[model samples]
Target: MIKNGEEKPTTNPVTAPYRYEISAEQCRSCDRCKKACKAGAIRGERGQAAYLIDEEK
Candidate 1:
């Protein structure tokens, strides 16, 4: 396949059938993880139990 005006390799990358997730009930609302995320893919707020990761990222 062509990408960025360049041809890509014929090899296919491996992908997992499952994804990691943290339940809202399991979340303690700690800001540590959010702070550690440099890509800003993690969406959540401190003091709030709900959290989610952006699949696009």
Candidate 2:
């Protein structure tokens, strides 16, 4: 029911989940990671001991 060059459609597709995390205790609060984050997921005060991460971002 198909031509020689025809291709079959995929019924299911595989996807990789997006993953990111920040270690509050290990973080030096250098603000480097916050600046690099394009999604603005990282939030905290400058020179603070810890930072926060927004998973929904």
Candidate 3:
């Protein structure tokens, strides 16, 4: 088969797993962000530094 002025479509390649981070100093630890995350990825005590677990997400 021959094509004239036609090209095939391309797809975006998959990239590395996404990494989430939170600033412990900046975080107020209000628990609002944790509550919003339905995936339960955020873990840590209230009024303390919170960590984001990639596996939990």
Clashes of each: 0, 0, 0
Q: State residue 1's C-alpha deviation in candidate 2, in Å.
A: 30
**Alpha carbon deviation, residue 53, candidate 1 (Å):** 0.9
- What would the per-residue lDDT of candidate 2 be over residues 1-57, giving only the tens digit for each residue? 333445855443446767877776688989999999999998998897788888998
Give the per-residue Cα lDDT of candidate 3 at 33: 72
Error of 1 at 32 (Å): 1.3
lDDT against true structure, model 3: 0.69
Model 2: ten consecutive residues of lowest lDDT: 1-10
On residues 15-51, what C-alpha lDDT tens digit does candidate 1 reach at each position?
A: 5544557677788878776788777778888887677
User: Could you arrange the candidates by TM-score from highest to lowest?
Assistant: 2, 1, 3
Best by TM-score: 2
Q: Give every collision pair in model 3.
A: none
Worst 10 residues of 1 by lDDT: 1-10
Q: What is the C-alpha RMSD of each candidate to the true structure, in Å?
A: 5.2, 6.6, 7.1
TM-score for all predictions?
Answer: 0.56, 0.64, 0.52
The Cα error of candidate 1 at residue 5, in Å, is 27
Q: lDDT of each prediction vs. the true structure?
A: 0.71, 0.80, 0.69
